[model samples]
Target: MYAQPQPQTTGRYIDLFPYIPWLLTGGMVFALIFGALWERTMVSTNLLVNPDTAAELKPIQLKKEPIGALRIDVNASISYNQWVTYEIQVKDQQGKVLASGIKQAWAESGTWVEEGESGTWAENDLMGGLDVRANQSEPVIIAIDVLEYSDTAGKEIDKPVSFQVIVKNGVVDDRYLWTGLFGTLLLSVLALFTVSSTGKVVINKSNPDSDVVARAICGNKDRLIRVVVKVQSDEYSPSSLHIRLTVNDANGEQLYSQTHLVNVKRSKSDGKVTSGSSALTTFFVLEPRGSYGFHAEVTPDASVDRTRIIVRENARTLFPVKVVTLKSSDAQ
Candidate 1:
């Protein structure tokens, strides 16, 4: 008579496949943070412009490798409800226009009353940014031209509008990084369902009789096996169900046995009570590469009109489960 070996209960076993997506997520986060820090280390300059006057900033030298970027930010001092627009251009040392754009700044405030609530709210927005990539290391000049100054009523203002411009180099573009992070997160969610399945169903029977019996052959030794029993009952069935699972070796000798309790709950849909089903699972390890017999029995057989039994081999879960050792007397 050959005795079966006990299941391994020592060190932990971690499956790294499920965690690969999280690892990729971490990498994208690191990249976004690193890009922000690198942007702060670049050179920045500020210039002032008055009405009807153009401001030309000093020549700026850019890095050749990795290519450099230029960012222009404009700020204006105006009266309430006033708006100002500026034309911005990036030119080479020879005065050739490399890039050009327009930006606007405005400020406004008003009162609102809705649903017996009255409050004063002030809102302002600025659409004043120009970003361009610098392909050459040669010095370039930034030029700013005041295009228009007016009030919210479309009336031209005679007063001069002072403007401040900020120019920065080596600014990293975060659009691609954000896109990559989003794509990686989506794929990670999808991988959880596709890559984490390690179990294969050996037997699946519906509406099985009490004391259901099945045989399964395992090609691998010391692999985990899972038994699942599901019961579907109407609202009139009992609240709880008891189940018994037994495993035996080729010689008809019992190896393990355990009892499970499944609770049944009733659900309401479209103003009608519906049947509810619950499942109970038991796990064990088969040590020898051979065929084994499984037996399952459910109590209150009349209450459980619908029953399903499943036997799975090489079963693995996303999380670890505790496997308890059973003595010879535990079998019934």
Candidate 2:
């Protein structure tokens, strides 16, 4: 007698439904970290800049690209009729030169121009230069390739080799200081702001980043500040934009003040106001680590005639930040 067909036993399997979202989230996080690491291994850049020299080195990635490339940029203030040359070399940890080339200076302009690759270096005469009065600092770029690959320990590797940039026969421009001095005096009179204590000093305790557009307004010989005024409509139908700027010193002395008027444009068909932006630049001799304050008054005119005045709002001030000089040593 078949003692009742033996009861079938089945094992339960784990379901992934509840854990799928968490697993996917963890996988995405892992992928992001891995992608960042892989990208870092592909390409890298080093920059060095100072009053005398500015240099940058960029190594190209060859993992996906068939041909490897290295780009170098050098900025130097060469005086009129002065000439300089540069040299690049790739050395292993033991200081073995794997590749060597000389920077070519151009003749007609006396600066390097984009000419196709000629071996590792360019023609000899292309490296010379004479700085123009208006444009003193000349920019030079050198692009090379991985002649051979090797590790820092001297073992053969399939990656781009690392190198150092050395400047030879280079001189610091003597006229640089003079240029800065003249520039500061000119910008102080034109674009700088000077506000009186009577107007307003709205200190921004927490400087929240605002959406404003600013471009190079003006400069003292070497330093400049950009200004952008955001005018919220004071009147329902403002016809124009008026901005007043004031610059104050540490002791609260007003150094400068200026008023700017921007005419509003309207569409002929519907008379709708068109949006616009205004920017101003000022250059001056700014002391390092010094705090400067900028205050602005924005008004929207609602007059039907261009000459009439419109309602105005209280002035606004941006949080003051110290001016810090940027150095090549700061770059990684």
Looking at model 1, residue 94 earns an lDDT score of: 90
TM-score of each: 0.71, 0.23
Model 1 C-alpha lDDT per residue in residues 107-192, reported as the tens digit of each score: 89888999999998877765477877755567778787777888899898766556566766566677988998998898888767
State the weakest 10-residue window (summed lDDT) of model 1. Answer: 323-332
**On a 0 to 100 scale, what is the lDDT of residue 128 in model 1?**
75
Query: Which residue runs of candidate 1 sit more than 4 Å off their true CA positions?
Result: 1-6, 10-14, 41-47, 75-80, 160-164, 193-196, 205-219, 222-224, 229-243, 248-254, 260-282, 285-308, 317-332
Indicate the residue-level lDDT of 144 in model 2: 32
- The per-model lDDT (C-alpha) reads 0.69, 0.33
Where is the poorest 10-residue window by lDDT in model 2?
308-317
What lDDT is reached at residue 98 by model 2?
Answer: 40
> In model 1, how large is the Cα lDDT of residue 55?
74
For model 2, residues 278-300, the per-residue Cα lDDT tens digits are 33322223333234455655554
